[model samples]
Target: MYNRIILKLSGEALAGEKSGVNFDNDVIKAIVGQIKKIVSNGTEVALVIGGGNFWRGRSADSKMDRCKADQIGMLATVMNAIYVADFLNQDGVEAVVQTPFKCGTMTEEFSKASALNHLKNGRVVIFAGGLGHPMFSTDTITALRGAELEADALFFAKNVDGVYDSDPNENPNAKKIDEIKCEDIIKNNLKVIDLTAASLCFEQKIPVVIFGLNEENSIVRAVGGQKLGTIVTV
Candidate 1:
């Protein structure tokens, strides 16, 4: 159903066995293996990844000041981008990392035109550093890039299988939603995307597929419109 899609991955998914703040090479390769399958299916992909595995911005501020914490979080994302891009390249896929904040020798400047150029060239562009600003999550960047690139949909892949009424990890009785409206996510306070990200997609009339990356070939399934997760739409 989607020709071009923006895929968002949580940083925690990159951690193999460790609880958090660690990189697992095998996990990165596993994801890129799935990404290769999606690309082979003639789907163009752009990526935005969170930095929670290395650093959580808000949590870092509990020890240091807010701005300093945010910067540390941004650097963590840049490191992930570098590793992910390298892994994709090793898998024989052309991948580029673009950051909203400049990191010489690591990534290119983040811009809609540059991203489109990469997509047109059949390169997977990984957008890093969460819109290059503090207080904005990678979810917001995912929505913004989805709208800007005119992608058919946004695929939000995390550790969980799909969107739930409550935090599935914390609530055993939480029900997984197959589909939902953007308004329901907002009004019901569903922990899908943040308010700003949800609002952007709603206003842009963009469809989102919230799915799990734990399963193999999940990205391909998402692009193929398989019934693998919850659909959030207007």
Candidate 2:
């Protein structure tokens, strides 16, 4: 089992297949239930959320300034982090939201020391804001935080079950890869993660698991070392 892990969540996953809703209460609760289960098992958890539900930097506004779009996207993540944090608290998990930009009581400013302290005290730390810079994905922050926090693995919970040779949505014959290496991911340009983040994970030697969060008991199984999805290592 993973002693410490960074759960990387996409904003769209929080919507939980519910259209026209900012968030799904039941879905969030279910996710929290998984977290609670893992925490009870004595595993340390941290979160990195994406802003795809509200805004995706390159897709939201093609004509807008890149930096501005990324900043707005970053704020979207803060919104997600707070929502998840609130649910975790309601579910009895001690949670805190830390961001690079000040949200003025909405959340605390992020510091390595403070975040580590919270984790040490058994509080779930939700990391918001993507590297506090433009042109960077939350995936990048996943690698950064996973390395800084010394997490055993990075759990990338996504829409798909695992990494595939082709887009499953387009090709019915797409094959799911159970395990792979970071070198193969980059060489094939598989799009499992951004090049920068993938490279960082490779350099840091941080193991990664890409799996579908929608699967029943996915988080629980993933953290329990069940080998749910594509496992990426050195």
Best by lDDT: 2
Q: Write the per-residue lDDT of candidate 1 for residues 1-234, one digit (tens) a residue.
A: 568999999888889677634788888888999888888777889988888888886684576877778777888888888889999999988999998777887789888888898887779999888766677888998999999999999999978888988888899999999999998888877777888999999999998998988877888887887898899988
Root-mean-square deviation of each candidate, in angstroms?
A: 1.5, 1.0
Q: Estimate each model's TM-score.
A: 0.94, 0.97
Superposition error at 21 for model 2 (Å): 1.0
RMSD from true fold, candidate 1: 1.5
- List clash counts for every candidate, in order: 0, 0
lDDT of 2 by residue, 6-109 (tens): 99999998888789987988988999999999988989999999988888776855798999989999999999999999899988999999988888989999
lDDT of each: 0.86, 0.91
